[model samples]
Target chain A: MQLKKIKSLIEIMDEKNLTKIDYEDKDLKISLEKSNISELEEDNEDGWIISPTVGTYLDRDKPLKVGQKVKKNEVLFIINSMKVLNNIVAPRDGIIEEILVKENDMLEYNQKVMKLG
Target chain B: MIKKILVANRGEIAVRIIKTCKELNIKTVAIYSKCDKDSYHVFLADEAYCVGESNPSNSYLNADSIIQIATNTGCNAIHPGYGFLSEDYKFAKKVIENNLIFIGPSLDVMEKIYDKQKLKDVLKQINVPLIESYKLKEFIKSKDKNIYPILIKQVNGGGGRGIKIVSSPSELEQTIKELNKTLKEKFDINNYYVEKYIDVYRHIEVQVIADKYGNISILPERDCSIQRNFQKFIEETPSSINNKKLLDEIKQEALKIFQFLKYDNVGTAEFLVDSNFNYYFLEINARIQVEHTITEVVSDIDIVEEQINISDGNKNEKETFITPNYYALECRINAEDPNNNFISSSGKIDILNLPSGRNIRVDSYIYQGYSLKPFYDSLLMKVITYDKIRNRAINKMQSCLDEIIISGIKTNIDFNYEIINGKDFKKGNYKFKKY
Candidate 1:
């Protein structure tokens, strides 16, 4: 997505008071999210990845650690939800800034799994 | 035995169940949406998990997610305190299929009671006096206009949501369409029924607790006539029913219904007692109710503990009726502006001072700095007061309401304070229609 288009989407999000939005076309796809926890005390500047289901978290082939560099769409972890393994990929290229959860830990939906920078 | 229970609810009821679990040495697991991360229930439970987003469909009503969390957390049973999937027979059935106990009525009892038409038929077989009712389609086809001033209600609607009063045949179809649309948008169910609307009636309900071995216990009746828009504002036990014979009759009728259905665990049977004291069976609430607090205070019984014991098949096999020792009253404090048609208000609580005394108890999940969210119900707390004398109990409730201090939002505290002190309430004949 173009920078101008992304800015416009952010503007739309602000106008509609939406927490997240997804845009896609034939060639490119983008998922944007913004924090609605302004009232909460623990607000952070870095992007946070949240769990999508209540299940056990498992690392891919190798264990992931903090400060590890990651690429966009790379398989970062898998969540075993109801016996089905769901691969959670990186939303964008960034270093593994903070790992909040450990491998084999049970994850609840919307729980903070990792932070990206 | 149930060593661990997943409480599939939130707010005061979750806290209520956790207190009992602590007493019984059963571990508790609480599920919350993201918005409820800082809720009191989360802090009180042995283990807490985020179910989903703030929307109930993705979180509280998400049966699959709830079941997954229970199985993963090693929960031996699930206690749906009230609302959400508490009365959902399908969810109860799924829990049994997954080899976990559902801490409520059996699947067969739930199925029979949930079907409004079938419930009425069963009651008819047992000679229960039910209100004259008809399905929406059947009522529309009938040419008889004698049943005018009928109430159009959603078959699946409870808690005073989908109900309308039509005075004449001319407005019957229009009201039905409106009710159907509202039901469709809310419950996704398009079915409705019409019942002969009694112009003057008192809302009284009986609490019944049964075991697997057909042992049923009927507690004291509660008078829930202090209502607005069909939602109860104040619930009192001993019911202000001066006649002991009438009270016994109501209990007998409730016991008969439970015995016929072979209902297990704790549930409520609601009735509409009219001017002449002719009681008409309304429906059954197949779960623990909000007003169960007052009954517990008066009867000196831990109903939640009883529910746990019954579900575990440890209850004694004998039927008994318990008379209340005190007159107890409960007022639900909601975060709503009574002056503005009860529109809900939400904000961070700056100060919280709950009332406490000799016979006063407050059941709530709010605390200082708690951010009241708009996504949930407006009820903030339940203030209960009890005494040997009914008048003294009302006076105690009036003083208790005055002592409550919740800042940073519009609450119905002042509104409730006025109701308890009003002349009608003092006279012991308060009517909802008059309110």
Candidate 2:
């Protein structure tokens, strides 16, 4: 059973692009943790990066019509966290492919507030 | 009688002050740095404003910005909780000038006690026992006969910043040079003094509450002998000193100092007692101490409330006095590596399991998914335990520590366990220097 658990961790690491996994069974626990160097680098190249700040979603509030061109660093929405209003900017100069959050909605940190293509 | 108060700080202390204000039915306004936008205190306060950038010099320490916030918010008072501008006499003066009560001592009183050397002079005038030594130049002149193994301390410093030990005359010059550089760079004070180093001495402090009506009361002494890097890590009450006479004498002296200072509000007088039972007055903390919970646990007096009331010109209820009833212990759980020079570690808290039971209390602002910031003190939580007996209190504290589960961030929990189990601590035969 221990060998099988270790084999499964290795498979999960490759399948999901995950670096670490903590598992526990009764008193016997194991942590297959990887270094943080690769994880930080992986954030630069992403398919759909979520907004790291909390605020209201602008794109979702007013759905972008088809073929809307969004410039790089153009604020797509604002996430207000009761303290500061964060301007969620586009990751790259791309088209607004989709919107994920609604207006006047509470946003969580690092949640997918919007999607930019 | 403060209708509104502006907290001139951020993070847990701000939240703590806000909670006290809420209990007193006082509206609270919090001023936060740009980086602390999502701080819990900002959400908990009735109103909040952005002061400036994340750096302390620009935000929390900016007296002008804080005064402006308080004036704009229409706050009648401002509470500078402990750090930043808490001890700044100029800031306190500014608050008073703006017709806002600074929830601390008057500017004149603060100025009198802010400098360590000046405070020592005051204690000396009152016949407080102080270690003997001379200035650096005097010691350098009389090196052979005057100078011995002594502690080199900065004249205007606290929190163990510019301090060193010189064992012999040969190393005196170099040590002084280094300490001078560090003192000038850190505290901007080039003055230095030397004192006889008291080895194997227990650090004990008495918490005193003095009102404007000239009534002073001493709330039992706390033994903070367990320390790391000259900073207190664990504090306990009913210090295994069973000598009733000695305890009474120390309490009387502490009260005498408070009376002499004409101090109005809460303060702590620290002392170092050697193996021979000879106690020497170290210094006075003119503000709320970190280990105040130990006293509160035994005394059953809400010190924060008392300070607020006293500042508002309300008299303390004479019947509501503090007398030590049982033993209490407080362990400061810091986010630092015990094995490595106590270096701080910052990360998100993945899991939190605080212990709760009879007479066990945990004061913290941390929750699951909360990130430990690297720009502040490493203290993550303060766990206090109380019992009828000292040994039982220690045992309960150990059990509580064992039950606490903190992941993602490495804490000094393991070191705390080692300290509670160590022979010197178990026997109550420890000193602050051991840390």
Candidate 3:
């Protein structure tokens, strides 16, 4: 019934390698089918900025906003793990495509934090 | 104090380091190859990353990727375990360049020790016995059946690579060509030298430890003589040498090398002992070796913990010469079907039964339902036992091996059984034979 629920179902389908899913409830009935083709290849003439540790991730001072151009060696964010603050640096010069994480979000080891191109 | 550390190698050593880190309250980051996603080391770490693909050149050996992972994961230090980048000069330099702690010898010390010829020259000054290694070209061109029995060894080789024993001048040319071809194809290495092959020899290594403050300690020597094709399967400490005088001499020689080099952290200086009890230095392994477990049990010291503490600048505060209180033996079990000529047995581990109880420790990375990739070393577990005497230790080790059970994949457990329960092993007379 809700779009968020539908999106979550699609994610489960992807994880389970399922092509179709059916659901029926007191007030909702739905059947979704996924096409065989994989999604678009990510364009990152520059690759993604990935999280290096398991911790709550927070942006650097003056919060990094998406669509901003980043230079090589720039401090993008900080991952605080076991009481140590580690800076996540830009591997090379690139423009931020999207920030996949929010401030104070718990990030697993090596999670992609930003897409760069 | 290190809050988090990255383990850059895989297999039991990675798992071993993680256990120590957990004991010291240090967080650990594990890096694995794509094929090793299900590896025990990955599942044991506080956090894990897929560094690269299954091919070692792209993953475990990918120094840059490992460094990036360490920095990204907030690791303040890196433990290069043993093999992958343990003695790498450039990688150690890079780690120091990034201001992260490298838990081994400094690049300067490593370079000095890792240069085999230079190390020999340096140690010769201290009266350390060393076998003469001939120049490659001289060895190739010489008409020396006079030096008939000789070994062609790669300059930078380990784990049984680039080693061929030639008995006659007639076999020299063909063997060198074959070895060079394999070395080039696998390692892109082309350098090798000729050393007089000792037909009958014993492998003895001295375990040495040093702190940054120059305090060095030498532990009891270990007899790593029992091997198949140069790969050690059984290792024992308190070498069967009942003659205290000769054993003491061996330990002193090892200590002299350690002090002379100002070596730091844990390392073992290997030697080949001839029948007359004369010792000759083979090389120095500058990392936490796989057989370190036996030393731990015998000496009652946690080597990995000491490594971490020393990295944090601990001053070998408890430095002292160590004489093992108990005799210890280790059996290396691998996922290989020995019946089929040691072909790798890769697949799901369906059932598992591990040995426990007094005087026994089982170090392994496999679990029930764990599947293995065919692209790595075959060592699956180490069964170590300790007791008041060597005979008791050997018996305990055989029992431990008998108690281990894992189905759905063939293992060399029985091969280990023969060694531990065999007459030659009990007699402590097992020595390497020419192929």
* TM-score leader: 1
Docking class of 3: incorrect
Which ranges in model 1 have alpha carbons more than 4 Å from their true place?
Answer: A1-47, A60-71, A94-104, A115-117, B143-146, B179-190, B317-319
Sorted by DockQ (best first), the order is 1, 3, 2
Q: List-wise, what DockQ does each model earn?
A: 0.56, 0.03, 0.05
Q: What residue runs in model 2 are displaced by over 4 Å at the alpha carbon?
A: A1-117, B133-145, B179-191, B319-321
Q: Which parts of model 3 have CA positions greater than 4 angstroms off?
A: A1-117, B183-190, B433-435
**lDDT of model 3, residue B388:** 94
Expressed as tens digits, the lDDT of each residue in A42-101 for candidate 1 is 223356777888888998899788999988788889999867899988877788888888
Task: Please report the interface RMSD of model 3 to 1 decimal.
Answer: 7.3
In Å, residue A4's CA in model 3 sits off its true spot by 54
- lDDT per residue for candidate 1 within B353-433, as digits (tens), equals 999989999999999999997888888999999999989988999888888888999999988899888888887875545
TM-score of chain B of each: 0.96, 0.93, 0.95
Residue range B1-435, candidate 3, lDDT tens digits: 899999999989999999999998999999888678888999999999877678887778877677767877789999998777888878898888877999988776888876666677788788777787775676666665376688877666665554777887768867766755766666432356677877556788889888988888888888888777778888889787546787788888888888788888888888888887777889898888889999999888999998888888888865557988899989899898989988889988889999998999989888889887788888888999999988988887778877888998999888778766878778876665422
Candidate 3, position B307, lDDT: 89
TM-score of chain A of 2: 0.50
User: Scoring only the second chain, what is candidate 1's TM-score?
Assistant: 0.96
